[model samples]
Target: MLAPFLIMLREGVEAALIVGIIASYLKQVGRSDMMPAVWLGILTAVALALFVGTGLQMVSAEFPQKEQELFEALVGVVAVAVLTSMVFWMRKAARSIKGELHASVDRALSGSAFALIAMVFLAVAREGLESVFFLLAIFQQSNDALAPLGALLGVAAAVVIGYGIYAGGVRLDLRRFFRWTGVFILFVAAGLLANAVKAFHEAGLWNGLQETAFDISHILPADGPLGSLLSGMLGYRDAPTVGEVIVYVVFLAATLIPFLAPASPATSRAAARPARQKV
Candidate 1:
């Protein structure tokens, strides 16, 4: 529940921010009349995301048990890849995103109404599709039926928070929020990677270091309150395979060290500067 909640919140807030910024930019440039088109694009992108996600889920539901395991492994792998790229992309793009978006709006307006719609759709679609994959992965791993509700609540909360920010009712340090949440997401991503490896092994595609790493079920059974929370959030297992443990630890180490480290002076300057290209 916690896992899906936080991830969806991040994705939703990002999408909302993009929409808000685009709307604000449009108004600033006396293009307020085009807001209906913006809304159209956003709604269309959202619909497409929902359709794609539902289609994937329904298709996956028809698979046999072994095929299902393999599909789960593939989806986890893709989710991890998408999530990692998104995290780094946000880290780099945050600094100049506004300027870049404004430029995009300018170019889009010069073309046609369809161009603006396409622009908005493409921008928000990335976030929506990313959220879909995250939800799929989380739903697959969760045992409780309330995970979907948790995800919906998270997205709702994000919408409210986004409105507050846009309306000047909330003053948030977005960089700080993203930085902390990024660490949390990276932890979750590590767990997903381990889960993917285990799924592959279950699918009979992996068989290396299959020995049990440790057993702590007596101390913290997965069904317990705390255990379940950790299991859902960090992919905790009472007794995991050696491969899973290795991947989990190694993934955390590789990602966390660089993510938590302070940006170099040159990198900071580069990020602070607006892009020279119109795009």
Candidate 2:
């Protein structure tokens, strides 16, 4: 439940930031008339995300047992990939995002209306798609009703925060927020990757190491309240397979090492600078 909420919160803030940037740029250039294009793009992206998520859920309901496992594995893998890419992309893009958006707005303003709409659509759609994948992966694993409720709350919070930022009523240390959140996301992705490996093994697609890494079920059953919470948030498996452990460790090492390493002088400076929120 918490997993989807945080994922959606981060993703929602990203989408909101992109839209806010575009809107502010339009006003700066006296092209506020094009604001409708931006709204059109945002609404279209939201519709696209909802349609795709619903369609996928409906289709998954019809799969056989083995096929369902395979589908889950695929979804998990895709989600992990998308999650990793988004984390790194945000880390690199944070510094120059405003400038890049401004440049794109300049070009869009000079081009056809279609170009302006496309710019906003692509920016928002990318984040929406990321949320869909993460949410679906999480939903498949937990199948908890509270997950959706948590997601709704997270999105509501994000909207309120975004509005506050836009209205200049809020002051956030966005860099620190993103940095810590990115770390948390890495832990979540590691669990997802481990679960994906387990799923593939269950599907009989990868059966190399079948040995159990350890069994803590006696102490902490996966279905227990705390266990379920851990399972959902950290992908806790009482009797994890060897492959699952290996994949989890490998993913963490590959991603976390670089993520936790010291930032370059320029990147540090950029992170240290106050966040710019113009709307």
Candidate 3:
């Protein structure tokens, strides 16, 4: 529940931030007339994301057990990729995002509405698609029925928070927020990667080292309250396969080390700079 919420909140704020920045730039340059096109692009991107998510869900529902596991594994892999890229890309793009957006706006002003719409569409669609993948992955992993509600509320809160930032009512340290959340997201991604491996094994696609890594199922069942919490948030399988444990630990070591390592001078400076959300 909390996993999807935070993921969606982060993603939602990012999409909102992009739209806010573009809207502000338009007003600054006396091209506020272009705002409608920007919105149209955003809506179009949103529609595309919804269409894709719904289509995948509808198709996957008809699959047999093994095929469904394979499908889930595929979704988990894509979600991990999307989650990792979103975190690292934001770290790299934070500094130059405003300037790039401004440049795109300038180019759009020189051309046609199609250009402006395309720009916003592509930008927002990235976030939308990321959300779809992560959300679907979360839904696929969880046994809880309320996960969707948590996700919905997260998006709602993000919209409110994003608007507050844009309207000058919120003064969050976005860099810190993202840093903490990035840590959390890396943890989640590790869990997803492990689960994906487990799913692959279940689908009969990969069947090596099929030993039980550990068995705490008697004490902490995966479906119980505390167990489910850990399972959802940290991918804690009570009796995880040896392969699952190996991938989880290795993924964490690989990603967490680099993520927490010191940044270069240029990256430090750029990440130090706060996102300019106020008009």
Candidate 4:
């Protein structure tokens, strides 16, 4: 539940930020009459995301047991890849996102109405699609009823935050917010990597290195209340296999180090630009 909540909140806010920037640019350029096209694009992107998510779920429902495991494993791997890319991309893009978006809006406005719709659709669609994959992976890993509720709450909160920002009723250090969330998402992605490895082993696609790293089920079973929460959030396991443990450790080491490193000079300059300009 916690996993879905954070993922959705982050992704939702990102989509909102994209749309908000585009809207702001349009108004600034006295193109407010084209606002309907922006809303149309958002609605189309959202509908497409829902359709894709539903289609994937329905297709998975028809798979046999082994096939289902394989599918889940594939989904887990893709989810991790997508989530990791998103985190890193946002970190790099956040600084100049407003400028880039404004430029795109300018180009879009110079073109046909279709161009305007396409601009907004493509921007928001990326975020929506990313959210879909992450949510699908989370749903596959946990069957808790609270997962959907968490997603709803997260998205609702993101909407409020986005609105507040656009209305100039709220102020936040977006740099810090994204930095902390990026770290959290990295942790989640690591867990997804481990889970993917376990799923592969279960599906019989990975047979070598079949060894138990440790067994803590005797003390704290993963199904236990606290254990379940941890498992759902951090991919905790009672008795993880050797492959799972190794993959989990490697993922964390590789990603966390780079993520924690200081921002590049270009990135630092971009990040500092907004702070210098009084809102």
Candidate 4's residue-wise lDDT over 1-279, tens digit each?
898899888988888888888888788889999999999999999999999999999999999988898989999998999999998898887877787777677788888989999989998898888888888888998866798999999999999999988888989688888888899999899888888887888888998666999999989999999899988888899999888888989998998899879898887897657534522
lDDT of 3 by residue, 257-278 (tens): 8877768998766654543432
Query: Between prediction 2 and prediction 3, which has the larger TM-score?
Result: 3
TM-score of 2: 0.93
RMSD of 1: 1.6
What is the C-alpha lDDT profile of model 2 across 1-279, one tens digit per residue?
898788888888888888887887788888999999998988999999999999999999999998999999899899999999998888877877887788788889889888999999899899888888888889888756799998998899888888787777988777777777888888888998888888888898989877999999999999889898888888888999888889988999999989878789987677535334321
Model 4 misplacement above 4 A: 270-279
List candidate 2 stretches off by more than 4 Å.
266-279
Candidate 4 pairs with clashing backbones:
none
Rank by TM-score, highest first: 1, 4, 3, 2
What candidate 3 gets wrong by more than 4 Å, as runs, is 269-279
* Separate clash counts for every candidate: 0, 0, 0, 0
Error of 2 at 107 (Å): 0.4
Each prediction's whole-model lDDT (CA): 0.87, 0.85, 0.87, 0.87
